[model samples]
Target chain A: MKTLYIILAVFFLILSAIFSYLPLGTIALIPISFAFLFSYLVFKKSETPNNKFSKILLILTIVCLIFVLVKVFFIKNELEIDTKFEQQKIENNKDAKKDLEDLENDLE
Target chain B: MKKTLLILVLFFLVTSFKSDTENPVKSGESLVYSGSYNMSGLLTQIAQVNMTTEKVTTAKNNYLHFSCSLATYSKWDSFFKIRDVYESYVNPISLKPSLYKRNINEGGFIKKEKYVIKGSKVNSTVSFKNNQETQNSFTIGTNTVDVITFLYQMRTVNFANFKVGQTKSFTIVFDEKEMDISLKYMGKETINAGNLGKKECYKVSIAAKTAALKGKDKNIIWLTADEHKIPALIQFSIPVGVGNLTLKSATGI
Candidate 1:
């Protein structure tokens, strides 16, 4: 039973790694959380030879979760800040200014 | 036979003159405009605006319910597709909006705004798609109209009496902000349109004083030189291109 739990934990950690690379959004967090659950149970209250493996898996899953959270939440809306204040900065952009100039000329 | 022919000519002329007295804002009247945005001669059909005004009698007041829907064409749908519907109820006697509602979805962002006005104060609430909500208040005057109702109110003004370069100013409350909009009359001009070709129209440029609208937003509207005062053509200078919305058709007015 202990080996089974370790295998399951390793399987979920692998999925978390692949999904993180694929950028699956909040879905990637699910496997990572499950990996943590399985790793803790496999190593619970035991100092077996496999306990070291469980500890390593647990650390890996935690790191992957942090990465997924940062990618999904923080990196997704980088362009939003530009759009929110883009109206005031329209003149500073060369392409936008040129387009606007052409627009005014077209109106006349 | 000559007498009969003369009577027929008189009847035809009388009915032709009757079209000149068309009341644009009467119940069930509708106007549709289709246009495209041109960027450095590259044209793309980006917008279509439809407006319908109806006169209704409620238990308390006689109101004009105006509905305006604006949408982007399929070509521009890939970047940011907008489907917005704005409806406003105005007391025609006082020209003030009693209620206004907007359902807008641009790109993936969704927002719904509801404003209930009581005399000089307004209670407004906005519900967004991300489970976020906001409430606001505004002190408006009796002359303050919503954006949709403002179009109808502008038609009621007497433009012919104003001389060249004359300007008219009005305050309109839009999206939680009171905008001071000035329309400068640029004299009468003749322009060609897809449907109403070679028609003479009154030219007016928009100068709005509000943070909600940026200074880069420039617009010019041409109203028909008729008694009903229908908008003939509207051109806007946007960041991408100059959008031209020409009146295509009207009915029931």
Candidate 2:
């Protein structure tokens, strides 16, 4: 029983860590909560002194939770125009203008 | 007597298709929106969408250029970068599109498409990531238009005459194919219009007969009820979950 809980706690902790690193915002909280719950279960089931592994899992979950919380509250979504895209857009405009002029000549 | 009746019928047919109402969207107008994904009711903003219009003068003709672009936010750029632009050149008064272009680059997948519309026929060209290009021509309906022009033309529709639950259909050329699109009026709704604050808007639902768009009424949009008729909010449901685009700012209305 304790082994299963430990495995689950480790899996959820890794999942939450990945989610926290991404731009998923508060979604990491779901896996973080699960990690905490399973870690607690493992800690309770483990014999004394052997609870150190479970404690490590709890600490990792807390770290991911805090990181996600900070991002959700402090980070503002802003766009930085891609320079390559801008150049591509300019080139497209030139081509489109030439095409339009050709069409106008055809119509005339 | 028969000749007179035939002329009268032709006059009515021509007048019925002509709308004298002024266009609601004006050149120099721009609207910015924040695109967000909803997961279990939590909203995570992912991209910024900008819609702008400008007046362009060709060698012998003048037109209105309507452009919409979507760029992933700086933080999300590294994960799955996206920079897509859609443009339409249309008649200033009638809003009939003459040229349309789409440039899409998402996560390294690149595609370019253009359509030149002449009367009831469209000349289409497409280029993919592998540098393969194809050109084709298609006959379209008199009222058919490209997707970008269709979006702008949606504002010109006189919704006051529409009854609740009334549906208006349009044909839009997208991805080199003509598809049927429908908009159903769901009446008036007041929603949070982001930076514009609370606004009363016309609630409408969109339906398309395509695999990409699923569900009947899962995609809905709110356009401000004012003369500008700006698209204030949009809610769409995908296979995974729901997503939204909320208006962030408006200028040159």
Error of 1 at B135 (Å): 2.6
How accurately is candidate 2 docked according to DockQ? 0.60
Please provide, for model 2 over B200-252, each residue's C-alpha lDDT reduced to its tens digit, 9 standing for 90 to 100: 99998999888776688889989888877789998998877889999999989
Chain B TM, cand. 1: 0.82
Isolated chain A: TM-score per model? 0.65, 0.86
DockQ values for all predictions?
Answer: 0.01, 0.60
lDDT of 1 by residue, B1-253 (tens): 9999999999999966553123346668777777666555534455567787777554344667787777665434556776777877776665677778777878878888877777778878889998878888879877777888777777766676778888888888887888888888888898764455677888888878654333432588888777656787888776445778878776666
Across all models, the iRMS values in order are 19.6, 1.2
Off by over 4 Å in 1: A1-108, B1-24, B193-197, B211-218
Writing each residue's lDDT as its tens digit, candidate 1 over A4-101 gives 88889999999989867653456677788889999888779457766677789888998898888787567622112234323422322333234333
Q: Per candidate, chain B TM-score? A: 0.82, 0.90
Candidate 1 CA-lDDT value:
0.70
Best by lDDT: 2
